[model samples]
Target: MTPAIPLVLLGLLDAAFSGFRAYAGSDARIRKQRFATRAGLRGLAVGAALLLAPTLTAALLLVTGDQARTYNTLAAGGLGYLLPLTVYATAVLLSLAAYFALPFRASTLAVVVGLGPLTLLRPLAIAAACLGAVLNGGGGSALLVGTIAGAAVLCVEPTVHRRWYHHVQ
Candidate 1:
């Protein structure tokens, strides 16, 4: 499968985790049980919204000519290499958005916290992608992807956090 699919799914899972947490807060489980379905569905929506840029970027890249690409077949310096960087950038942007908008809603906070596992691995993912691309004799495209991905992932989080609060509230 394409690497993009997994990244987007990870985004979905992260959001779903947060959604469940939002509903199951400091209350009885039975009380919040009814909201489970709604929460899960909404989580998917939120995940889509949050990862829309990267997901769409991946789709666009694939449609343009990278359709045959898979993680295993990702050629360095090719358009396919951009997917990881884009995912990384999207995540960074979200984080930056949140950092700048501190003291957000607890639910939004929960979403941020819930992404802990994926967030932790993002750096490694990007590093490996970039390093592998370079070692594979990649050139401008790979470098460009890394630069932009680094910029975006480092930038989006805080922005999304601030904006997402308005939605959750």
Candidate 2:
């Protein structure tokens, strides 16, 4: 419960980035055809995926290990959250680099600017979300749960995009 907000934020970021990528990568013809309808479909699919993500993630984590049951003080959490934090920091740096490259690619900025960097950020975002959940939930077990949940969430946008792109059109 304590980690709920962080997890929600992570899910939101996943959907947003995914949606952006899909839209940018789509065919121009498709983008121009009933654009609003396609966008709405994408939104609905991503929303449904977001709701389903946590349940599947929780089930997978719960059945997989005993380590997922252990709680610890932040001090006791030790290296569990460390690696994730480091990865998240690296992602932030890379994302910054991508943003800096914006001016150079200004022409295509609207279409492809955020695609690679955002895709690259997915795993790192999961790591960051997991660490936040572990600390907030006061348990190392939350680390595993967070990891699975964040990973599950990462698929939301892409899955939605694929589904809607085919069906909505």
Encode model 2's per-residue lDDT on 1-169: one tens digit a residue: 2334444554555455456555654555744646644654575457556656555654454566454354233223324444454466455446556666656566356225444555666676666656655666437555655565565556666676676565443
How many times do residue backbones clash in model 2? 0
For model 1, how does the per-residue alpha-carbon lDDT over 7-97 read when each residue is reduced to its tens digit? 4465566566445544444344566566775665665666566565544544455466545553223444433454554676576557656
Candidate 2: deviation at residue 101, Å? 13
lDDT of 1 at 79: 35
Worst 10 residues of 2 by lDDT: 70-79
Candidate 1 TM-score versus the reference: 0.40
Q: What lDDT is obtained when candidate 2 is compared to the true structure?
A: 0.53
Q: Which stretches of candidate 1 lie over 4 Å from their true place?
A: 26-29, 59-169
* Candidate 2 error regions (>4 Å): 1-3, 30-37, 40-44, 53-115, 131-140, 166-169
